[model samples]
Target: MTSLWHRRRQPDDVPTPVAVAVSDFCRRAKAAATPTEVREALALLADEDDFRVRSLTDTEPERSPLGPFAVVDILRGTAPELASQRQGCGYYEVVRELARVREEKAPPAPAPTGLTFAAPPAAPSPSSETPPEGSTARAGKSARQAAETLQSRIAPRRREPLAETEPYEAEESVSFKRALPKPRGRFTQVAAPKASYQTLLHVEGKGILESALAQNEHRFALLKSLSEQYNGAKGELGLPDLEGALQRHELMDRLTSRERQGLLAAYTEQRGAAGRVAWSLGLSPSELQRLVSMLQLQAEVEGVRERFQREALGTRHLTQRLDLLGRDKYLADLGIKKRFTEMLRKEMEDLARGELPDAVDLPGLCLAIARKHGAPQELVLRALERLGLSEGLRKQLLAHSNHSSP
Candidate 1:
């Protein structure tokens, strides 16, 4: 039930600099002689707190004749401080003069039309704010009319409706389609054709994206296949899938020393003819002759070595037998003395004939003879030394005699 004036003043009750300025403006406006001066003064007042002043002057020009007296009425009712200030400046005197002049020039009052002037728009009261019962329907009709007016402005009515039939009929009814008639009511949206470059750019972008996706998928499949193959091989070999083992397996070891030597020998001797040689031993004349010569030389050298080993073994065996049995009895039993002398004579003849590979170890040969005959090693060495088997051989026998004395 609070009055609008009280309600508006309640929040802004405390005096402010704007209020003081407003009070000054109101005093000046009241003293102003002409409506022009009054309007200019009101325009200078604070817009936020004095919006009613501007509204009364600008929006409702019909109320300008009331002058600053109307403004004083509004301020007095709404704000007590500004009102008190205006009163001190003889604000009431100005209002009275204006009222007197207005009454002198006033027209006769018209009969009430069951209508009231709208209350000046401050904080609104419910009773005064409600429109009459029928006004809502009238407002809705006005709004619809206004919307239609706007729509008509945007799209003007066509001068003539489209004809039902085509303007010119073709004699043979051409295959090409005719344009369709315009639709009634709301405007239809038309699609615009895109530029060639824009269309190409979009198509190219889509193609590139699809191509990249396909390539990515192919690469993924390849990697997956390789991974499966590797894992299958590892399982077959019973190898652990340890980290970094793939790199270690890739680093293969080189051929060993014996394998390298055998490979070199095979390469040197066989060259490119190994396959032909294996298929048939039928060789060219030069190759065949060289092969026979090499075989003969190898056989002769091997035979000599074998004979030398057999002689040494036989001499040792004879020595052991002579030790077991007296030499004369052994020699008489088998005539070994004559056989031993003949063998020694043959060996000496071979050396004199230069049939041996190198100078023979005469001391070693003589020692073997001495052992076979059951004679002292020193007696054998002294006999070999007197036989003049070179100075080197003499020195060798002397060392051997001393070593074997035990």
Candidate 2:
């Protein structure tokens, strides 16, 4: 692996002129001394706490050491060239010896691990290096013990284990749940190429999503990911359940523009109350506004409604409907695409206008959804009362309409 030493610096460290001068002088005057010693001695004079007041009248003003250290500080600390430098040992061999000896008592390896020492650090022979004097070696330890201690500390990677782990309460109780059966089909019905015809349709209230598009894109993506988490087999309900997983589906979308407007209209005009509308009609809001904007143009209201329903319905009812139809029924209807909310609304309005027979209206189906969802007919009464149509209208609607409006 390449060392970090070669990596380019994020920012170049610029050296001060003072550092350059001190370093240059130290190098020339004390050619044999380590950078640390020269640095310290120079610093002593350069610092505010200087002990020496040396004048560089001779060939080497830095020969004494104090003058160079202050300059060295600015050099090493700031210089881009010295950014990767490690600490270098100088004349302070005493502290070095103590540090090294402290580590020697750590542990010994069974094998030499190809370790080789340059020489006995205690008995310094030659070379320019003058290792610091450590504490006196004990006279009692044999050469074997000395070798073992020395061998223990130098090897890298291998760490000395301090203690072994033992079992606490040996007998622990455990429980296990049986695996769920695999889904009868492949991982997802979505894999069926014929399952959906996902095409975008233009509608009226497109501006409803203008500001929220980017944010809702992220939320929708998360919701899509939520749709992917599967475990075991199909449950008793037979629907793919992200809700059961209970992963936080915190990304509730704000009401779409058309939903807000329609809900507001429904509240203020139809129900004679105003606050928040259905709040769930994001798709409806989009369709409503887009229809108003494009209503005069070539855009068909159903197209926009289809778009809204596709996004708004979000496959809950579609999936269940598809599942009910099974492979055979699905193939016949070209895979059972759902109708848009606007279309359904138009149908309901036609029924109310006496244009369609009761058999063709949602009275039957609404009742079914009503009973299944435990809906309140209170909303129909609420709508009629707000419209101030006949008090008879209120009572009839309350008797007939289901609670499942949203």
Candidate 3:
């Protein structure tokens, strides 16, 4: 996937001094081979104007120019061999520290000016003594006369009360039909709460304990080691030899339900090496590795499932809100991808039907779709290719891909 930083850049756009410096820092960070080198690159970035660094770090994730994921990737470096050795978490720690520094160094904002109004002139109190009968008294008399005239003009006119009339008597009695009684047994049914992962694990563990008791001694010991591993034991415990144990016919039988599930649970919980797990489960290292891969694949599928569910709910909510406002057409072209291939398939169909303009920028469109839908560009490209497209469009996409390749 292209980093968000690269995705945000346009071919014609010129890099600002700050952008150029930050880009250099990111390049250096990616080239770092050791923790010390990573720290040095971070220091260089931090040495920039505090406000500039703070602005970049303070940007919200969704619209951020340099996001946490991009920062972590830089910290992890470009080398696949060194990926396992890198500590991407440290980059976030540094960002947090920078944030603290920025907060401490920042000046307080100026207070807002409050609205003020001139007080109305105080009304003169009535005086017992009459004012000296010259200009002041004449002016006061004129003002009073003008005020009375204005009040009389704006005041509402009073209406005279109408004379009382005799009430009429109904010739026949009026009747209202009685309302029907509501139907009974209209109670709503509440759904059962879903079981939590920990609760499910506890139930599974109890079941495993019961079934393991009937298994052979060797198999039971294997289960015990697996349980310990799942619970996060670090060093190896004294147990059956992994190599010879696998050769035994009874042990060689396809993994029981508990065994397969326990392996997955252990793999997820264990923080140590796969070797520890292999030793615990009485399986060869290679077999355990393969199982781990399968578990990872399963986890990815489960994650995708959860993401789709969330997207579906969000899309539905947005559609309902838009419909209520009589603007559902705003969402006519907007949709959530229900499956991994759905987004690319939709785009391909749109292209085939000439729904998209002929001059549409293929690369920009793909990047936008990937970013909006939270899919990797590589996956988007792969799906597009698999689904097929016109020769010209395909060539244009391929050329863009080559030009953008790092």
Candidate 4:
């Protein structure tokens, strides 16, 4: 049987009927060849008034693998406008389909009113009209009168050009020059550019030093004192208290990418302090373990091994193995025989490299360790025997067992 530790967690909530139907529709939409087909599939759910169906439309692709949002993204390439419109309104696709159906079933619009108006009588053409008797003489007289009036209006406005004008004369040119200021009797010497403050530190190191110095001198000294005090206080704190303090301060969220990398470096510095480093960074041991696994997986996927040092890798692996042994005792409380046997094998291997105390009762020690890990004593002993426990320890354990069996 697989250990509880190895089993994946199942989601707590069962999917509703509407959500299941919507999910099925999304799957079909994903397989669709075009946006129209996808829309057609969605149209089936237009009348589904259940709110869960609508909620699924906006769910993230990661949470709902074949969600409506994902299907819309797939349709976007082929039908950008439709995709955009649908995205703007969750019910757009459904409303549009309903509107289209309504339009198809509705009666045709009434024809526009056809009221007509009479055209005005056409003006009589000049060529088609016959002049009245002496009408030509009257028209000629009117033309003569208009010409005379136009000449009268122009006569008063016209004036003869000036008879004479003064001859042009150029003005005499005048020049002025700017006067230069008198130089002072004494000259000021430019000081030699104060030998560019040389330093052995790199740019980053120099910046840090400069920042520290930028503070008030007294404040800088006080800061140093406070840092010392803080370090002492941190060292005195128990693991749980330290973790709580870090959580209260939200220190992990405050750390920058560079600071996080530095923290990782610190974690790798000491193999045994992995748990301590994790807690100091406001991470639970499980979170730290997951982070390590993620890093390893990322390195494998990217085909890059240099990112993590050999020491770091060794530390992480050791931390993971130690973590297995350090799991909550309740995880093994089910006491499955096969799982206990497997755990016993691992525990025996772990113990093989260490010294066994002559003063201790071997059977009792084994039993205690197994019970602490929620494993059966029989399985632990059998595993120890199979994995070659030291001959002397094995004989002592067996004798103790026989003696106690009564």
Best by TM-score: 3
For model 2, how does the per-residue alpha-carbon lDDT over 132-202 read when each residue is reduced to its tens digit? 44423442244456777666667655533223222212325455978887676656445422211111012
Q: How badly does each model clash, as a count of residue pairs?
A: 0, 19, 0, 0
Give lDDT for model 1: 0.39
Write down the lDDT that model 2 would get.
0.33
Q: Give the Cα lDDT of each candidate.
A: 0.39, 0.33, 0.41, 0.41
In candidate 3, how many Å is residue 217 off?
14
Q: What C-alpha lDDT does candidate 4 achieve relative to the native structure?
A: 0.41
Angstrom error of the Cα, residue 222, model 1: value is: 99
lDDT of 4 by residue, 1-406 (tens): 1111110111112133443445555554332123333333343332333454555445533211243443434333425334433544554445445545654565655654543333333354588587665766766676667666665555434343223222111224456877867665566455333211122122443443334434412222323423432332334323343223333444323322334454455555432355555655566667656655634433432222232222222333332333333232322322232453465456565653242432256666666655556654444554566545646576765675676676
Worst 10 residues of 2 by lDDT: 1-10
User: Which of the predicted structures, 2 or 4, would earn the higher lDDT when compared with the native?
Assistant: 4
lDDT of 3: 0.41
Model 1 has a clash total of 0
**Candidate 1 per-residue lDDT over residues 1-406, each given as its tens digit:** 1121111222123233333343334444333233322332333234454655444334322211233444645544535334444554666455555544544465644643443333233343477777766776766676667666655555533343222232111124556788888875567665443223222134343443233334422222222323433333223211122112322333111112222333234323433233332224334435433433533433533343345334433664433432323233333323345565455445434433342222246645555556555664444444334334436554555575666668
TM-score of 3: 0.23
Where is model 4 poorest over a 10-residue stretch in terms of lDDT?
Answer: 1-10
lDDT of 3 by residue, 1-406 (tens): 2121121211112223333344433443342222222232233333333355435434422211232234434334433223222334354345445544554465655654443333333354477355555756766677777666766655555454223222112124456978867555755455444322232134454454345445633344554545443432223322333322333333334444445566755444432234455676676766665655644545643454355345433453322322222222212212222342354356455643352333245555555555655654434444455555445565665675677769
